[model samples]
Target: MATDVTVPTDLWEGDLEAVITNWLASDGQAVKQGALLAEIMVEKSQFEVTAPADGTLTITQAADAIVRKGDTIGRIG
Candidate 1:
């Protein structure tokens, strides 16, 4: 089974879009639930996105891409 890794809607206030600053783990890397996966920046503030489940990560959105809340950035399977 695969699980979608999403940018949390509650990461910050407002409907601001964020930039994917970096990915902690490369595509196809094995990850554990709650492990840091990527970093997102909104203006000057930054936040980290974590793995949603224990599986192999497949990045759908790469670094420097703009994303919104609840957007699926990757999948784990």
Candidate 2:
């Protein structure tokens, strides 16, 4: 089974959506729960997003992708 990783709704509020600034892990890589997976930039501030579960990361969205709260970014299995 696969687990969808969506952006946290409570992440932040702004006029524009968040942009992925950095990817700490690569697609198809094994990531542990609570590990830093990527960094998001919103309102000129950077925030790190962690893996929700221990599994192989499958990035459905690419780096530098524009995203919003509740958007599905990837899946883990």
Number of the top candidate by TM-score?
1
lDDT (tens digit, per residue) of candidate 2 on 4-74:
88887776766569998888899999999899988888989887788999999999878889999878888
Q: Which candidate achieves the best lDDT against the true structure?
A: 1
* Candidate 1 lDDT tens digits, 1-77: 99999999998999999999999999999999999999999998999999989999999999999999999999999
Q: Per-prediction count of colliding residue pairs?
A: 0, 0
Each prediction's TM-score against the native? 0.98, 0.90
Once fitted onto the true fold, the runs of candidate 1 whose alpha carbons sit more than 4 angstroms away are none
The total of clashing pairs for model 1 equals 0
Evaluated against the true structure, the overall lDDT of model 1 is 0.97
- Candidate 2, residue 66: Cα displacement in angstroms equals 0.6
Candidate 1 C-alpha error for residue 76, in Å: 0.3
Error (Å) of candidate 1 at residue 34 is 0.8
